[model samples]
Target: MSDMTIGKVAQAVGVGVETIRFYERRGLIEQPLRPKSGGYRVYPDETVQRVQFIRRAQHLGFSLREIAELLSLRASHGTDAIEVRQRATAKLQDVDHKIERLRHIRRGLMALLDRCPGQGPLRCCSIIDALEHDQRLASEPAERKEPDMQTVRLTIKGMHCDGCAEIVRHVLEQQPGVKGCSVSHENGEAKVAVDTSQTSGERLAEAVQGAGYSASLVTEAG
Candidate 1:
């Protein structure tokens, strides 16, 4: 078939006319020039297929930039399947990491819920207290003695503001053996001092992750 009007192309591709225009603006698709008669901008039939391809890629979690690269690879000569596979593999790994993070978040939330007594004074509510104080509901006994003091550095992600840093600092300080912690949102890192007998770097990392962020132990000091 010959070229189609923008409306017809949108109908064929099951997308809105503005969506096509947006794709054009994003350089995902070309915008045909108006004819000398100046009636309407028409799109080639191939645009329908390309739009479909873009939508399919989006459903597979490919960003517009990645889709553009995929389109370029498709149009380029001597492109290897391995190149496409590598991108897919990277995306898969990203999805897996997100899934694991979500699971960790779920566990943290469930633990909080389990500790909360449904009926209690607002100030005494475990959930409310946890949020207000940045501490877990159930913590280690206060009688535990500190023998070995250690300091650990952690690389944190997803902190966007000063409030997030403050929350992270409080969470660390509230941990069983944690004596103190310094969190910097600008640096995306935290240095924590703890009693090694009660908490390790790994445990500190888990505490940070449980507070709705990603954290990894960078270094440990005795």
Candidate 2:
């Protein structure tokens, strides 16, 4: 068997070196064999293909643990129909759930797009008007006037317009420590200022997603 180093495997697979380390830590891949000759850890050239498999599975929404399970399944039963059927059934259910959600949203949008009042821009958009109402709660004088200077930026997706941006910002601003939050429709970025004493990134992300958006911590640089 041709020996390969971690860097060689990562290079061959088109992934960063750290990604291989993460796969090792996650138990999704095997560790390299460190020979007694001390020529640095050497892996089988097959590791490149394995890393490629992992990246493809991750894109398909398989978690690392699930990928490990899949590897185990493949090792034990390459042609077992029963186990394959069960895995397909579970994955199908996941797909069905997503499809159902999409269908519901499609129906709602059809109504909104067709029933849009022809009065004018401000008066015609039912979506924006509803979101504006949601943010009205923040205008209350009793709320905290200001929050600390700590800023968090969440990388978000699924925002198609200013309405979506407004909706996320309106929802995030309601959190206790969050004095203000704003989403850029152009870039799918959200800038927020919060007081650590009241709310955290977890809290803010939950709040934003709860309203209707996808978000996650991409970075936290000052």
**Which prediction has the highest TM-score against the true structure?**
1
Write one digit per residue (lDDT tens) for candidate 2, span 1-222: 478888888888888889999999998889967889888798887787788888997887677887887778777844343444344445555666677666666766665566567568786577676556653212222323333346677878889999999888888878886655667879888877666667788788888788778888656453
**Cα lDDT listed for each candidate:** 0.82, 0.73
lDDT of 1 by residue, 1-222 (tens): 788999999888898999999999999999999998889988888999999999999999999999999999999897655456556655665677667666667776888899889995887788877788777534332342325655678999999999999999998988986656678899999877666888788898999999999999985342
> Could you tell me which residue pairs clash in candidate 2?
none
TM-score of 1: 0.59
Q: Count residue pairs with overlapping backbones in model 1.
A: 0
Q: Considering every candidate listed, which one attains the maximal lDDT?
A: 1
